[model samples]
Target: MTKVISHVGFSTTARAGDLATLEDSIRRIVDLGADVAELALFGEDLIAGGRIIESRAKRLVEICAKFDIRYSVHGLIVSNFMDAAHLDWQKAVAKAMLELCRRIGADVLVQHSGQMPIGPRPMRERYDALEREALSEIADIAGKAGVRVALENIFAVADTEYRQTPSEVAETVRAVNHPALVGLIDFSHGYIETTRIGADFRAEIRAMAPVAGHLHVHDSFGRPYTMSKFYYTSEAIALGIGDLHMPLGWGDLPFDAIFDEIDPLPGTALIMEIGERFEAERADCLAKARDLAERVNRRFAADAA
Candidate 1:
């Protein structure tokens, strides 16, 4: 059975007292028949002034267990805000996340690779060393806690001086070469990251074959590809350029072929890693996920036939 996990990003709410919001979001996801919920740590309660505590972890665990949902961590994108090359904060956050994952019974942690190293070293050399060391350390720590780490490759426009390609995602995963760490592939991010690589999506997935741990599944989005001309951040956030993390099949993410490829991989988790869901779109999104899963199962059934 292919299990579908929903990240709380679906609700766009990530606060501590936002329990009511998360409860409502989980209800909708459960109603859609998903068996897992991804808990993001950056929203509200999980992290405070650059640290984590037991109370926040306990609250999250109780909520997920109440819904009979498996949990994972997703909001630990400390790299985007920090110096990726330095990696002091990245390692710290990863360690905190593994502890949270252990306490929550979530064996998976999904996160983006973040912007590449912005240091004084050679670009590729710096990226290679930083990613290798950081992920290797993360893997060792997570292995101790019996958790898996999945690195997501997101698209972003740089100040021209600070940008890294998605193929580096494949590159770094290969460089690390660990069983505890793997790749988390998203449609939009893969497309943007590999735009310059000339490799197809199937090739991208295959590249991470040895360490392909979990998946952040979604359909293609229609985000703006146009640069904001005035602002780098605006350009990065433009439509379809980055992973806005829309609902499955709602965006143009090309899941049909992608799913077909992964359908053969036994036990690979499919996480519906959408950004934020609004009250207006909640019910419909749930219905769509159910319908999409059924559609996937039927194809598998027919393929088996």
Candidate 2:
């Protein structure tokens, strides 16, 4: 059976700051049969304390032991455009974070490649360099820690129109040329990233068959013109893109078919990266994700029969 990890489980945008309240949050996620609980790598507490917070890392590992829930991964390596030195600092921070992840027995780390420049001075050159830096850093940190580092796809149409194509995203990974440097295919971002690959979601996954390790599964209904904003999600809704990251059943993403498509022979796992603020709505999201996963499994079983 394909394992599902609940993404940003305890840290919805509405309550991202309240990460200390994770006991109840983790209980709910584990109750839903999720294999892992993904938490944002940083919190206000981290902000106040410092990067190498051993106390925080110890608490994370303890919670996992108490709940029998593994800490999968969640983090954004701080990147800066104006100062390339930030990249080096972020790399050190990322390495330290992965060390924390290792201490907690977490398995995967998601980091971002730098954004494109606004005025465009050799963007391909800059992005490629950043990716190379990320890859080198991942090999040293995540690989050494035995945690996978997946580079996620970013799509902000308004922000310099950077990374509007999956090919560009894929090309960056290829350039990185490291084993731990993997691809994170967030469905909604993947849709907005390319005109050619939009809605051919499964094919896009198969295209990056070699490096894709984890999936950020969410749904959206915005086309370029309708979305003039050009993207949609609970995060986007918070950003005024659409209503919200409506639960699994609320969107038009062909999730069941997508589930059928992922073989994960190369280590890819599905993370239900949905967002709902209310406990009632979150419960609904869990039920739907479990139901959908169960149904897909039954179908696969019957097909074998």
Q: Each prediction's Cα lDDT score? A: 0.60, 0.58
Model 1 agreement with the true structure over 1-305: per-residue lDDT tens digits: 44332222232246555766776667766665556666656664675544676676677677777777666777565554225545676666667778778887887877677564355657657655666777788889888898888877666554333444445676777778877877766656676555534456567655554355566655555343444444543344344455555556555666556554443233445566554543456556556555545554566667776
Alpha-carbon shift of residue 17 in model 1 (angstroms): 6.3
> How does residue 69 of candidate 1 score in lDDT?
65
Error of 1 at 31 (Å): 2.8
Determine which window of 10 residues in candidate 1 has minimal summed lDDT: 3-12
Off by over 4 Å in 1: 1-12, 15-17, 80-86, 117-121, 159-167, 196-202, 221-225, 228-242, 263-265, 275-305
Best by lDDT: 1
Per-model TM-score on C-alpha atoms: 0.75, 0.75
Candidate 1 at 279: error in angstroms? 6.0
Q: Name the weakest run of 10 consecutive residues (lDDT summed) in model 2.
A: 5-14
